[model samples]
Target: MTDALSDLARAHGVATAYTTDRGHRVDVTPDTLVAVLAACGVDAGTERAARAALEAHRSERAARLLPPCVLVRVPVGDGSGGRGASDRRAGRRGGPQDPGGTDTTPPLYLPEHTHAAVQLEHGGTVPLSPGLPPGHHTLHVRTPDGRQACAPLLAVPERLPAPARRTWGFLVQLYSVLSRRSWGMGDLGDLAELASWSGRELGAGFVQLGPLHAVEPGALPDPSPYRPSSRRFADPMHVRVEAVPEYAYLDASARPAVERLVERARQLNDSVLSGSSLIDREAVLDLKRRALRAVHDVPLSPGRAAAFAAYTEREGQGLTDHATWCALADVYGGAWRSWPAELRDPRSPAVARAREELAEAVDHHRWLAWITDEQLAAAQAAAVGAGMPVGLVHDLAVGVAPEGADAWALQRCLATGMSVGAPPDDFNPRGQDWGQPPWRPDALAAEGYRPFAELLRAGLRHAGALRVDHVMGLSRLWWVPEGRPPTEGTYVGYDRDAMLGVLALEAYRAGAGVIGEDLGTVEDGMREELAARGMLGTSVQRFEYLGGSTGRHGPLPPDQWRADCLATLTTHDLPTTAAWLSGEHVELRARLGLLTRPEAAEKAAAAAERDGWLAELARLGLLPDPGGEVAALHRFLRLTPARMLGVWLPDATGDRRPQNLPGTATVHPNWRLPVADARGRPVPLEELPRTALLRTLADVFADLEEESPHDPHDTDRAPDDTTENANANETEERHGRPGSC
Candidate 1:
């Protein structure tokens, strides 16, 4: 451990905080042996054999950095190196779970060769069993007999199957869909009217929408839908432009000036649905860019101009260098990294003489990505014709805006001097960054994983379930780089077996279901290798916790969850759910001074405002106890059972507020506001089930009648490309009814 204290514990990037004078933490997280024996001036009792060689170089660096150590390349046995020192001391005294007593030299086992408890092995790459069935097999590691190790192709596990019960669902976010004919943002015709009102009314097995890619459209743009401008296209301000069927053959006397600009954009979406407020996305992209340039001057069909010139020649040259940098930012403007160097080369000849002096601004950004892919295939065919069963779900985001247009057309598989983020912990005690830019995991596995599998096959072609965001970035990603300070940054490891084998071969070729926003601070066994590959694991009911092994708690139920998850309570960067039951995120984090300790943040905000009014009087049974205040926090957040939940439509109308607020984005106003409606105002999704803030959020999911994991696409899409029309207000007589605490 003295290569200058293992290079000062690999320069402060592994601190799990040790030091009761060393080697005894069964509970891991001893801030990397007390910040590497407090940076080599040594202690841990005279560096207990340099803290047992810094716990055998952090147990051979968490078994060469964990995640079923990619099944230790299950190439059975080729002792290029591993399993030598006396059968790694007899599987380190035969594994009864080595509670930080420390081991692993030439060893790796889970339930022996993986049901994924944990393994980390790095190079010589073998790890077969993703459900194995490829070809030859065998991977024994020790007890002599000349050593067995063989492998041919490996991927057999019943030949990459699962994740396709119509790719599980539900995960909202497209600027919290302010619908009812949205123009003030929220489009693709209000995500095809919330997938035809979540498939008829909620048998909704799918509909996850956030990052409809394409952004930097201005009028207060940067509302951060993961800073786009071409994640292979879409964000034509969520194009609806009078629900373009080429605006019903225009020119009927130029249709009463586009019917008085669609009745002045339906009186500005009825003043943002009677002042629930905010919606003005540059006055709905200046009235749908004057109704899609007056219905693109009425002519296209020569087979829609050869399918928009074969989608501009199969989106060649990164959508023709981002439609020639939005036609040289409409006449040499908006920072093409501050243009003029051959107008920032989108294939220069001065960006092809500014695309032949702006061919109507590159045909209005290629007819705004063909009317945002014809309103995202008519909002996933109105969420599978509105009977529902997994209709939309899209998200994706995690990194993109180093001067957008997918960081200037995938700047050669990006990473330009780093910038991902998050390190200072105990939940952001400062460390955050998120300036966007990462992805050079060896130039996305030397582009074999074709630009992250063609941006996960263009968000599963109009998706019916995707979500991802930071699904622990497939496994490891802190990065930082660009002039450091996300606590001087580190953790870079990616290739989680070619990022979950390019997300199980693009959700098994785009039928679509993936999820992953696996919440914050994840490290140990990455939720058991994304639950042994069926990939679904986010919990959220305000961070559940009854202390581990998933039980003794309430919200932790739903069959200890992971059957390919979506389960929710609140996300779009937390807080809503009426500001987590009204202490208004503890008085907006103590009025943004972000409480360090003004008397333990005012006694943990007066005991979390008296346990949220005794969990709302134990959900109105008028609590035999909790008298002073503790409103049965939604009867203890609808007593667990989470396979899916996510109510946060501004916390189903109570709307306390918190789209985002990491570390004072200039005293806040982050992602600018708007989902309101119960007097705070902004409500729109066509006046939420005729408001009372969506009938007190459909009487709190009709008194938690359960069933919302929104099943179907647990990871690889297509349940029946949205089997169309069903939600005749479904909750099947208010959730599978059974009742209890």
Candidate 2:
């Protein structure tokens, strides 16, 4: 790349070159850099254009008296002044601070006799210097040179509060775990029951679920939860039909139609459980929508009507735009880009007229959003009430679908012609195009990050904690220009201080913990910065290797695990423990043409990795027999210092199939299978209490409670209600024991 182009790219926070995970350097082509710059609304097509853009950027910076925003990290205190006593505890004390409780940055460039003060968010004003409380405020400055400037100032907590003790929980893909009362898939009602039983009976401390964000409505919608239509709202399809309060008040005229819909939903559930059909999301959604329409027709009491009105008012314009998009989608389609030219812009006069024409439909979608929010709040309440310290840890998807609600509603904040993706890596030599647009850094700063702040606020509203997918995006993201290959993408950076400041402030206000999925292709110091904010990192068992350059690439020892992390045996995207032990995943991959290596070589490598863990477990005296391997692996997790441990829900029952297989879409049933046992028999929620495999695995993690006993309410052990070895024998008969490799 030419020097002029590189300078222009740097001015826009776009990288002309980057170092790969391997120890190699690759320079981005000049053409790629220009295209990416154009996506950021810069003109850099030629050397002359690039030089002009650079001059403009410099001139703009010199003319401005203050930056678009300022991030202030406050000091720790004892609840009276700053972060309080809880913030100084074991896992929460690494925030950026000097002796004076402020970060080290160059002094501001202003004329002499400059006056500065902060306009508090609520009411009054205070001096900009000295200690400022942790909240959002506005900074005002006036200089003797007759210049005045104002910007948004964010004063955030030094560190978030951590759990008082070590805790364990179940990690699940909610749609796969069904109950008898579910309408062909899991719902909020099922989540409540799962959390209540696990916390009260098995001593589990949390229930971390996959993202519940809304998906686009259509005859055939994308099934992956990671590519949501809107992250700000919960999916109404997950709402339990019977749990809505209005269901009980339905008039006689509306009763028979609802009854018929419920009966058909039961048939769908039975079909999935019997292995005759995969979970049909579209069909289930269709049934629920019809039944909900009947319930919506029921008259609400005065108090309930007032409550709904309050919710709509609090949500404000964001909710209205989302509901308007939904109403438009019903007439057109979910892809807003293809709508009529006049209606594409959300603020156009045509849209306002359309909203009036379809007022009832807009209200229906708004009502759906409100009802789903109520159910989510109820789920969190149920978990906390059942004695969980950290209940309902929710996941946040990295980005929304390009044709989805968020992309349409917030077009000004997103890059127009660039797709968020990854560069070429070892796992994917051709690289990957995720088909999601990234947030424009310049726009985020210009708007004072209101869109980003609102997104975080909504996610933490009903969560005890929130897990961020691809946390590395807070610093930088790869931008692939439209109609270009992923191999030609360049990295674009963001203001990390501002991004993290907004997150910390919002999470602090909600009293919620934060966890980041920093698993792959992470930048230097990203994990450390997250730790400084008291955010936990994720550690998967199979990916934790001991040595990098010493040629001793074995499984990391349990004792060497990091303390501030959520440790797990496997994740939804990877193979199950049982599949790993039996070499079934390798065979499945080979058959599906997803294997990059020879089948024999892949199998042999997988075996070596599995054996390494087995030897470690045996050495630690955690495994005694082949039948106990699954439990032993979980026992290995408990031996680590990780504060939070997550057991994949499918592992408890010896389910071998992954909920999602990343490479294949239609070839494999992704995100559509119900949770089943080793023999592929569906395991209902009510039946879980009597499963021997689940009971054995629970005992392994529950061993910690014997000494410390985190809960003081119970002094006696509950009677064993599980079946006596029958479930284990049946599993062994079908697939051999989990570890009998």
Candidate 3:
């Protein structure tokens, strides 16, 4: 690539080259860089154009006194360097303090003699003070030329708030955890009941749930939660119809229709719970939408009307745009790009007229959003009120679907002709295209990260903690251009400092912990940066192996695990413990033609891995037998000094099926299977606690809690170096006796 092109790309925070997961160096093609630049509105069609754009970018940067946004890390001194007491106790370290302690926080990079003042989010406009309080502010700058400019100024706390204690929770796929009350899949009511039972009865600290972001409300709703319509709003499909208070106020005439809808819902719920079918999200939502429309017809009470108005006022334009988009989609079809030219522009006069014409439909969507928000809030309240410290930790998807509401509404901020995805790795050599649009780094900065900030704030509103799916996107994302394979994609960089600052600012305000899913070939220094900001990293037991490819494979000793993490045995994309031990995942992969190697070879490799883990469990005196390894696995997680540990809800019941298969979309039942038992019978939320298998797992966690009643974060545990040698020997023995299984 030419120096001019490189400079242009760098100016827009587009990466020119990146190291692959396999330690191979891959350079971004000049064409790819140019395409990405064009998406950012830079004309880099030729070498001359690139040079001109590069020169202009440099001149603009040099002349500007302040960036579009200025993030100032404030030292609140509430103990964890402004992160509060919970963080300090949880072993979260803050950023480096300045020498002499005058102002430890790093200074904002403003031009010399810039004469800057800050307008706080609350009310006052203060001249740049040494010790500014933590909040979002507006920075006004005056250059030497008398030119004035304003930028969004975020005064963020030094670190994020952490958990008060080392806690254990159940990691759940909410839609899979159905109850008799649910139509087909689980709803917010089921979530509340589950949280109440787990927290008050089982002494659990939190219940981590899958993303509930709005999916495309089309003929066939996408089952995957990771690809959502809008990250800023909850999916109305997850709302329990009866849970809405307005349902009670329905007129006598509407009661018969509701009763008929209830009967259909009962049949759907029974079909799913009976293990006769998968959780049909489209069917469930279709039924619920009709029922909800009937309920929406009932006039709101005076108090309810005021509450609804208050919600709309607080949500502001973002909510308005979302509802408008939904209404437009209803008329023009789901893909806004295919709509009439005038209607494609969200701000166009034609679109404004359409909004007026479809005002009722828009209001209906707004009402659905309000009701969903209320239920989600109730679920969080239930968890906290039931004695849980962290309450509910909601998951945030990495990006929005290309044809979804967010993409249509925020088209300017999202890159065109690019999809976010992963490059080739050991698991998926063909690479993976998620079909989600990448956020244009330049556009985001130009908008002062408003969209990103709003999304974070919404996710954290009713959450005690937020799990960011593919958190690496905060720093960089793999952008695969249209018509290109994932392998042809290149990494695009984001201003991590600015992004992290906004995240910390919002999280601090909400007093919620942040867990970054920092798995799969994370860049160097990323983990340290996340830890410094008090964001927890995710650690899965299967992925926490030492020297596997070198023929010396074993689980990393739990004591050696990082303290600042949420340890788990598996994730939604991975198989449950039973499947892994039984080699069900391998067989399923083979059956679906997902396995790259021969079936026997894959099975052999899987068996060797399982044997190594079991041997380690035996060496630690935790595994009494092969059948008890599941319990031993939970015990092993407790042995880790991680701040939080999560038990896969299915693992407790010995479910063999994985909730989702990463590579396969339709060949396998991805994101549709309900939480089931050893016999493959779906287990409803109401029956979960009553099951002997779940109760046994709960007892194991409870027993561990009693034995170590004090904060587990305070407990010191040394790494077991001998375990590696033992695991190596076991690997050798297993290879010698291939028939051991």
After superposition of all CA atoms, the RMSD between model 1 and the true structure is 25.0
- Which scores higher on lDDT, 2 or 3? 2
Query: lDDT tens digits, residues 51-158, model 3?
Result: 999888778866765566666566756455542211112111112111111122233455456667778889988777646777767878776668888877667788
- Scanning candidate 2 in windows of ten residues, the lowest lDDT window is 732-741
lDDT of 3: 0.78
What residue runs in model 2 are displaced by over 4 Å at the alpha carbon? 76-110, 548-552, 625-627, 703-741
Q: Which has the higher TM-score value, candidate number 1 or candidate number 3? A: 3
lDDT (Cα, 0-100) at 424 in candidate 1? 53
User: For residues 550-630, what per-residue lDDT tens digits would candidate 2 score against the true structure?
Assistant: 123666777666667899998888899999999999999998998888999999988998998899988998778544889
* Model 1, span 647-705: residue lDDT tens: 55666556667766554546765555667743577766766666544443333444233
What clash pairs does model 3 have? Answer: 98-104
Task: State in Å the error of residue 408, model 3.
Answer: 1.3
Model 3: how far is 269 from its true place, Å?
Answer: 0.9
* True lDDT of residue 403, candidate 3: 83
TM-score of each: 0.30, 0.91, 0.91
